[model samples]
Target: MIRGIRGAVTVTENHAEDMIQETKRLIETMAEKNQIAPEDIASVFISITNDLNATFPAKALRLIDGWKYVPVMCMPEIDVPGGLEKCIRVMMTVNTSLGQKDVNHIYLNDAIQLRPDLMKEE
Candidate 1:
């Protein structure tokens, strides 16, 4: 069966380079924790908050994940009435035999603010 994993992270500042680095770091950490295989990756979708207009987060993943075969798409996040800023969210599906219980979801940096409960123990 296929499993879905999600992770979110934010740039330290508003810098494009920082966003790229943080996004790559969070994905790598999640992938390692979940033991993702390149061949098992179905695809990845990423969204950047309306405030961010720099490099796409998916570019960093393509450059760092070493999974040139997997599909990745990036887009600007919608500006909801009340929403987070300078945030990048990722959703990925992997072709895995493991169940959802075995998946690891990550929330890093300021993005953790979006999930205070998850960060309380960190």
Candidate 2:
């Protein structure tokens, strides 16, 4: 079966280093929390808020040891009124045996507020 894992993170500024670091952190956490192997990932779609345009988050994925071959795409998020700023969101599609309800969706930093209901007590 195939499933999509959602995740988001916030950066302090629009610096390329910060964007790359935060994106890597978010992706690693999502994979770790869900026990997802790099080879299991079918594709990853990342979107950053209009306020953040320093670099492409997909660059971080290529830096990962086993993720060089994984497909990834990055784009700008829709600019909505009152929307979260400096936020990077990701939707990773993976081949897994876990059911939809069992998948873990990660929200880090200020992005946690974007999905309070889905946040698990840590």
Candidate 3:
């Protein structure tokens, strides 16, 4: 069966390095938390807030081992009033035995505010 994992992270700046680093961190966290393997991933969709255009978030995945074969697409997130700034979000579809309810969603930094209900108290 296929399951989806969602994650988001905030970038401190619009620079390419910052975007790359933050996205790398987010993806790495998701992969680690869910035990996602490259062969299990179907595709990844990445969206960035309008304020962040310095680089595509998907580029960071290419730097990771075994992610080169995963299909990735990137787009601009819809700009809404009062939306969080400098945020990048990802939705990865993967073939997993885990049920949807078992999937772990990750949100880091200021982006955590975007999904309080999914976050567990730590």
Sorting all predicted structures by lDDT, with the top scorer first, yields 2, 3, 1
Q: Clash number for every model?
A: 0, 0, 0
How big is the positional error of residue 65 in model 3, measured in Å on the Cα after superposition?
A: 0.8
Give model 2's TM-score versus the native structure. 0.97
Whole-model lDDT, model 1: 0.80
Evaluated at residue 44, the lDDT of candidate 1 is 90
The parts of candidate 3 lying over 4 Å away from their true place are none
Q: lDDT for every model? A: 0.80, 0.93, 0.91
Error in Å for residue 28 of model 1: 0.4
- After TM-score superposition, the amount by which residue 31's alpha carbon in candidate 1 deviates from its true location, in angstroms, is 0.6
* lDDT tens digits by residue: candidate 3, 1-101: 98999999998888999999999999988988889999999999999999998988889999999889999999999999999999999999988888887
Q: Which stretches of candidate 2 lie over 4 Å from their true place?
A: none
RMSD of each: 2.1, 0.8, 1.0
lDDT of 2 by residue, 50-122 (tens): 9988899899998889898999999889999999999999999999998888888999999999988777666
Model 2 is weakest, by summed lDDT over 10 consecutive residues, at 113-122
Q: Compute each candidate's TM-score over C-alphas.
A: 0.87, 0.97, 0.96
Give the higher-TM-score candidate: 2 or 3.
2
